[model samples]
Target: TTVLTPDVLIIGAGPSGAAAASLLRQYGYQVLVLERQHFPRFSIGESLLPQSMVFLEEAGLLDAVEQAAPEFGFQFKNGAAFLRGNERTHFDFTDKFTAGPGTTWQIKRAPFDHVLAKQAAAYGAEIRYGHTVTAVDVDGETPCADVVDEDGFAYQVRPRFMLDASGFGRVLPKLLDLESPSNFPIRRAVFTHIADHFDPAEFDRNKILISVHQQHPQAWFWNIPFADGRCSFGVVAETDFYAQFGDLALDDLLPAILASEPSLSKLLSRAEFDTPVREIVGYSANVNSLTGRHFALLGNAGEFLDPVFSSGVTIALKSASLCAPLLHRFLQGGSVDWQTEYEQPLRRGIKVFRAYVEAWYEGSFQDVVFAVEPQDEVKRMVCSLLAGYAWDESNPMNNNSVKRLATLAEICRDGRAARDALGQA
Candidate 1:
């Protein structure tokens, strides 16, 4: 019977957990991170937002990421381009309203997650791969978990506090029955990697390309390019929308769907779909409580919005950034309010993103995005939100996203109508 004790216990060695460990270790805390999978595991979220760079730099892990960028084929990204039929526009992150890092990277999650875990280890955090947390017990004064190692050795870990950074695993939420129904409708994504034989002069490698389906604007494709000339391509839509292509394997179905989008079809006409296609269903999730007695859920464990904006990693890193300092203060015998100080602020940013996601699916946000002759100031404000500056209270978009977006949509429509009338006269 082996028992271990640490000042802080983190479940999952993904971005959030790894970042939390690094931050806590910087404060001289004995932090232990348990990860079920070994290094270089496959993950779906590859695109990153600029705001994530702030958290990585704060955790002192950005230098390692930069050093390993060349090895992992990380592609430089400064903005995102959107296309719907003949309408096309792009938002340069560097021109956003909020002030921060303007550029980020399109990463391969396998190596990206590994780099983060190793950096956390380098910062003196104890990370054990192939160790899975089977059960969690928080009824006692100290939080603890039952874990089984790869070799079948079982042990117990008791830590003064626990942070659940399990990402999609939702370890504590499931163990503690904290799950709740999400407000978002069920949606799914089918994706795979391709060897894109793109001409550098023809395609802009510095931005991610999002193409809307000509027939169904709600369904869209994300083309994320890597430095090695391969691209991560995926299509997203409501779960029922996929039912039309019955019994079609991802490999066969993806190509058929791609042909339906004229713009994307033409762009990737020379691409080779060499890898296996994959699918993820109903990934949107929510929980009843974010913090409960010596423990707090981080990232997807707390809540998850749509992936249309690529906010997953940013939210994960932001959670780690917000939780670490509060945990340190609590460990130092300070009265720390986990709800107001940690959970509320994190949810505020998430709420801002949620409003946009709702508008994206409902078509209001898309109207503004594709609006002809959009106001420059309005574009910058919306660009800030797109760049993952969801927490900036100074930005008007973050404060009243839904109302402002609706108003903007109406104005765009009216302007278009007036233009049509003038042309007829």
Candidate 2:
């Protein structure tokens, strides 16, 4: 066994862990990142929001990410058609945030995560791949962690502070006896990546493309483009939907469902399959406690919402930035009243997500607004909230608007009634 000491110990090397380590290093704190796998691994949720771009720039990795930027676009759905073609919402980074791009790039997450982890290393974080954390011992004065790497090598991380960013790995959840279940009837994800299925020369690549299925309110799909004309598409639906794939191969299994959704059917009419099918179950969680003892839960480790908004990475980075300074204080032989710094913000974020998810189910999503066209002022205000700006107090939907929307949604809980004139936006 090898024993190594660091100021901060981070378990799980996804965006949150990387962000924590990167920011800690910037503060001259010795940070150790323990990852179970190597870099450049494939991941889903390839689409992004404009606010997320600002975060990447803040982390100093934006310039590096542009080398692989896909075309910028947003495809909002109402009936079957996207309200705009080529023209979409590029608001934040365009006329308002900056004249830069106003759009977030569609990316292949494998290389993207790798770039972020590498940027952390460049910022002076000590990252050890294949270093899987096995167990943890916690105390406010001293915290101990045990990690096992491949080849049966064991190492100990004795850090003054710890941040668990092991999303859905449920590290802190298990310790705290927390339960995070699938909130919707939809429980699984079936997706695939195909080459030659997406080509800028052949298909519209200016905005993010989407397919809205009218039959099920829960059903929708994304078609994201990356380098080399590769395209990724998938569905997040009820777990039992797996029965459809029972007999036929994916290439053969895709058509029947495609035909059910007019929009998806039209887009894939000319495209061809290029890879094997893949699937994952959807999960939702809310921890009773986000901080305790000497450790803290960051990002999905604290809790996770659905993937519909593509918010995993942004929240990860932001949460890490929020908590890094607190950990830094602990590392400096100073006592940290972390709860004083994190409790309110954490509760606010959790309440906001709960309200948002409740409406997604309770309201039949009649008022659930997606960006279909250039939005009017109030519409954009709601869209910005959906786009993950809930933390900003000045934002319309942050305080009063969400309350108003919640009241409206409650009044129109049933499907037909939600669409009634009184419920009109």
Candidate 3:
């Protein structure tokens, strides 16, 4: 029966947890991170937004990531390509109105996450792997967590403050009963990695391909190419859509669904599965509050919108960067407002992404994206949002995304109608 104490205790070693540990350790605070899994474990969310670079740099992980990128064969990504039938549109992050890094990378989460966690360890944060936090008692002045190691050795950790970065594990949300209904419906994704023999001349390896099903607009596929000639492929659709396949092995289901998308089917026709097909269901989640006495939730521990925009890692890193400074101040015996300083601001950016995601699924934003002639300024604004500049107030698209998107969609509709009338004349 050993008791460990640290200035702060983090419940997971994912991006959010590691970022927080790295930042807090820079402020000379002792950080203890407990993780349920080992390093280099499999995870999703391969595509990254450019805005995440700032946070990584701030956490002193940029250099490590840069060195590991090439070693891991991560692909350099400057933009995203969207396709529907024969129409195609590309958004280059460098063309965005934002004033930050324009390019990011499409990485395997296993190595990317491991690199970030290792960087935190290099910064002197104590990260313990294979230690699962089973219970947390937050009623007292000092919160304590019950952790069990892989060999079933149990211990207690007492820290002045606690940060829950347990990701989809939702440690605090379930233990504290903070779960709330999400506005999004239950959706599912079937994903796998493939060794793709892509013709470099035919495919722009610098961008992720997002292809919409010609017949099933509600279903979409992601083809993220890696430098190692392997691609991460996945399809997202409503749960019922997958349920129709009912207990079919993922390997069998992948090809059947992929056949529906002609473009994706043709592109990956020469590809072979490099890993087992996997599935994730009901990933969209939310909680009533992000903070309580002595504890706050980060990353997926608090909320998750949808993966359509590839906003998960960006949001997670944003939460870590936002919460660390505030938590540092509070630990220094200063009064801190978690609601105003942390939760509200964090949710503001997430809300921006939420609006765009809603419009995307409803097919309104697609109209603007595929418009024959779109306004340059509007395109730049939308590109800024897509580049992860959701918090930039100078961009009107970030402030009123739904309204602005609707207006753009209407403009496209009118232009099409005018062309149709002229043809009739």
Candidate 4:
């Protein structure tokens, strides 16, 4: 077996891997990326939060992404629209208190991920496609990964440190027995892309649409439209909720589920499924630790919460950005505090998103979001969080989101009571 050596070895070519590779290369490290699949492959998480642009710019990939935007038919996204029956509300990212660009893009993940990997390759990171890591040994001073290519050529790679950005593959976690119980219950999503022609008058293509099921409080749907006139549609609900449709094929299950949500049904009335229906279940995961003796986890490799509010890519980029500088320090022989510097700060933002996600399903955040007239400051705070500024401590909502959300929701409930009393008088 041939032996390869690099300063850093990354296990996946997904967003987190590519971002980490790009940033590490900028810090003068020889980075090797291994991917089990080729580029432009099917994956979910197409929508991007505005804060991701900062990390892209830091990695010098912003221009490439900008050029590919029009070439790949990416839609410019300014905000998100939430709908539940007739109660509609929109939170414009631009209106938030964040300092960076208020708008981001909604692109096809396959090509978008390809572009990111390509950008990393251009930056001198060696990305080998079809290389699946079968085993990893991180107990040694130098971490090593055993890999096999599609052609069945096996090899070993030794790197000073490893970054497991393998996403849902969770390569390191599974190999090292690092898996931990997640706080979230099991959830499933049934999704597909559709060729939908949108009437600009009826739909604001500039923002993603999130519609909650009128009957099932635990259920929610996403409508992410692209510039190519195609939209990604999906529904997420508890696993038990989905089991009721057990054994039903996606084609039939999708239509049957969509019929239950009126807003989504009307919006997708003329749309036709352009791709086969796909389903993913129990995606919420966590790890016992984000780092070990010679390696660290990035993005979904470490933890993955629910996809409501589109936090997956944001957290992935955040993990990559957070891990890059500290990894650089370790490579340079500087004593790096892994837990204090890398994991704590990273999980802080994650906890903020987690609170909001839990509140969303509990019906409190939904009530606050769909309020007839919410306080301007509170709405902006919520918008800032939605825009991926969860780490900004200046935003009280980020500092203690659960308490603030509960308070705001109570205010909303009280306001409704007063209005009803006045109407009766």
Candidate 5:
């Protein structure tokens, strides 16, 4: 057996990369983290789901997160049919998900990434800020990285394993030639932070709020209130949904959504934005194949579904946790079995999430009639499902979605049968 170089080379110093590096270091392994950007950069997807609380505790960053984030758990409002609009539907995890008062965080990507990166460094993982990974030398039996620094000096960090936790599938996937195709179906989101006096209920505990304005299937917007009295609002429009709006800028997207929703229209008409609108082409799953002999990808680098549920943080940390044990075993003279453990379950999770996202796509959730409606059973079920409760194999796979999907599927069947009979007549 030959000796290897560094224990782990983590690409992308985002939350997932930081978690993997920090955890590996905690168990006594030499880890290196490289990031293309410095700390405190602008990022999107502010609202987080409840399951993320569990993962943050695992990463030992829970305390830090609580300090930086507001105390709001999660609230699902709007998205009801006209008949049900009198009473809005909301989800308080305290009611169901009995994992001991679990609550998620609404974090700005810049500060969140900065905290995680610094924590990883403090845990003894060597972190290089502004150092980008140009290429990876996976040809060797022990895969290594061909990296370039700020000075354009190229060198090799020969590590036993490489982890690409880069959000948006940066290096490995492209190198693996994992191109995201149009059939993949993506959405264009335009978001910005606004500080104009919107008052949530008094009992909200200053916690971040996740607000979904019903637009039906074409597009839907979100409002995530942070601890700083500012709410991050973004609109997710289906591919080419904004094609006709070319004359309009991103800042106008939110106002457009508000105009379509009576509730939001009144609320935001009195508000002002704190920043310029930022746009992103997001919520698309990546090509398969996350594992190779010496390199594995994590987070969005591997699989990214719609942000409707705020599962980005949870997905990355969850995947990293799964990889941790395997990496641990290998580090301790134990064999790493990629086939039995990593590949199969990974596939299942990805498929389950994809199916769930597809449902949202099909329904379009953008219809003002359905979105701004008050409390109703179907609306409750929809919100529960959206806020990270689809009940996949990881959690208790809820029968709710299957039931709803089945009910809808049957209606389609019945309608088809009637059509056939009429044709015969």
Candidate 6:
């Protein structure tokens, strides 16, 4: 029976919501963020790309993040390492073609998100936890939401502009019927945290390791290490591929799959899988429209391609950084084109990631990554994309990613075949 109005209403105090609130507040807007969950709640997507640091810095939250590094056990990360059978390759973010921060942290999402939300609140943004948006109406001039508190109190919030940053929750997408089937095929991931015990020299704790299944080209594992001797390990494969396992419990399932990847299995042999194994099926999603009226969707609320590249948080923060300024301009009575200024540009970066994700599953990118002799310039460009510089227009890979990646892949494969023929000769 209460009504509250804010200049901007952000749903979900996750990365995107927190970043947007901070950015808008910096621009002198009154921002209210509603989060259904409390701080320090468990969440996935533990990896962070270098590009995320730019947004955190711009939002004035990077200082807080760096300050929390020791307390939160934030792991130092400089690059990513990949493995398949006996071949191995790594991309040092510092060697990338892009001109930006070359290193970032491998984070625990729970603490990372809490830090961001807390910092945003410290910056004068009002953040209400345990408040869920049950209904949304954006058809009118002002976008509003019917929210219910934990104590059963119900209220309505009307804001001049609304942003949905509900990662995977997709609150507005579900409420307003903006959901669309993702173009990528259905996939699933089974994961858990482990008290990883490894010799410092044996494994590179500073880099996330992705190991491909020797037998199943479509299956892969992500080993994301944390500074506190803990690591996140997960396996992703097409949904039907898991059907063969047939209702096996996660505890039994994950270890069984890990046994198939020799390198990962040996590396994790002595590690403890302390947490309960978890599974997420069909996580890839999309939206029919990114914005309407006074509202727009940010991060996973709009579209989610895949987790293979760990692009979730980067995209979430990118969407926030891109939208805050445009929304600020509109609030200042300046004409803004949401389609061209926001959606199109955002989707362009997304498309670049999409092409890589698709190529990843199709095996083309793997060939490019593990090539016997990849060109330094080409590798640097690929490293830029991997570093989450997808929006950089100067990068040739950003334009026509699918075609360019395909051509590069073909060239790598041909060179590989020629080398094999010479070896036989």
Colliding pairs, model 1: none
Model 4 accuracy (lDDT, Cα): 0.88
Question: How accurate locally is residue 187 in candidate 1, as Cα lDDT from 0 to 100?
Answer: 89
221 in model 6: Cα distance from truth in Å? 0.2
Q: Please, what are the lDDT tens digits per residue for candidate 1 over residues 1-425?
A: 79899999999999999999999999999999999999999998889999999999999999999999999999999999898888788889999889999999999999999999999999999999999999999999898899999999999999999999898899998999999999888889999999988777657888988888888878989999999999999999998877777888889999999987887787788999999999999999999889988999988888999889999999999999999999999999998888899989999999999998898888877877787343456677788888999999998768777787777777766765322321232
lDDT of each: 0.89, 0.64, 0.88, 0.88, 0.63, 0.89
- Once fitted onto the true fold, the runs of candidate 4 whose alpha carbons sit more than 4 angstroms away are 243-247, 372-375, 416-425
- State the lDDT of candidate 2 residue by residue for 152-248, as single tens digits: 8887888877889988786867765755563556566667876535434435653455454566655556666654556667766666665855776
Model 6, span 259-315: residue lDDT tens: 867877887888887789999999999998999888999999999999999999999
Query: What is the model-wide C-alpha lDDT for candidate 6?
Result: 0.89
Candidate 2 weakest lDDT stretch, 10 residues? 76-85
**lDDT tens digits, residue span 130-216, model 4:** 999999998787989999999999999999999999999999999999999898888999999988776778789889999999989
Residue 280, candidate 6: C-alpha displacement in angstroms: 0.8
TM-score of each: 0.96, 0.82, 0.96, 0.96, 0.82, 0.96
Q: Which ranges of candidate 5 are over 4 A from the true structure? A: 1-4, 70-87, 97-101, 180-184, 201-216, 244-246, 364-404, 408-425
Candidate 3 overall lDDT versus native: 0.88
- Return the number of clashes found in candidate 3: 0
lDDT, model 2? 0.64
Off by over 4 Å in 3: 243-247, 372-375, 416-425
Per-prediction RMSD in angstroms?
A: 3.3, 5.1, 3.5, 3.3, 6.3, 3.2
lDDT, candidate 5, 1-425, per-residue tens: 22336788899888889888878987899998888787877667666666655666777776666665443322222211111123243445443322333355566777877777788888898888788887776777788777777888677788878899888746898876765552456677778878746654421423333344453444665666666666777777776766655567667766666566666555556568768888777557665577888877788887777776576777787778778879888868788777567756655655555555555556523222133223323433334444454434323323334443444444334443322221232
- Candidate 4 colliding pairs: none
Give the Cα error of residue 205 in candidate 4, in Å: 0.7
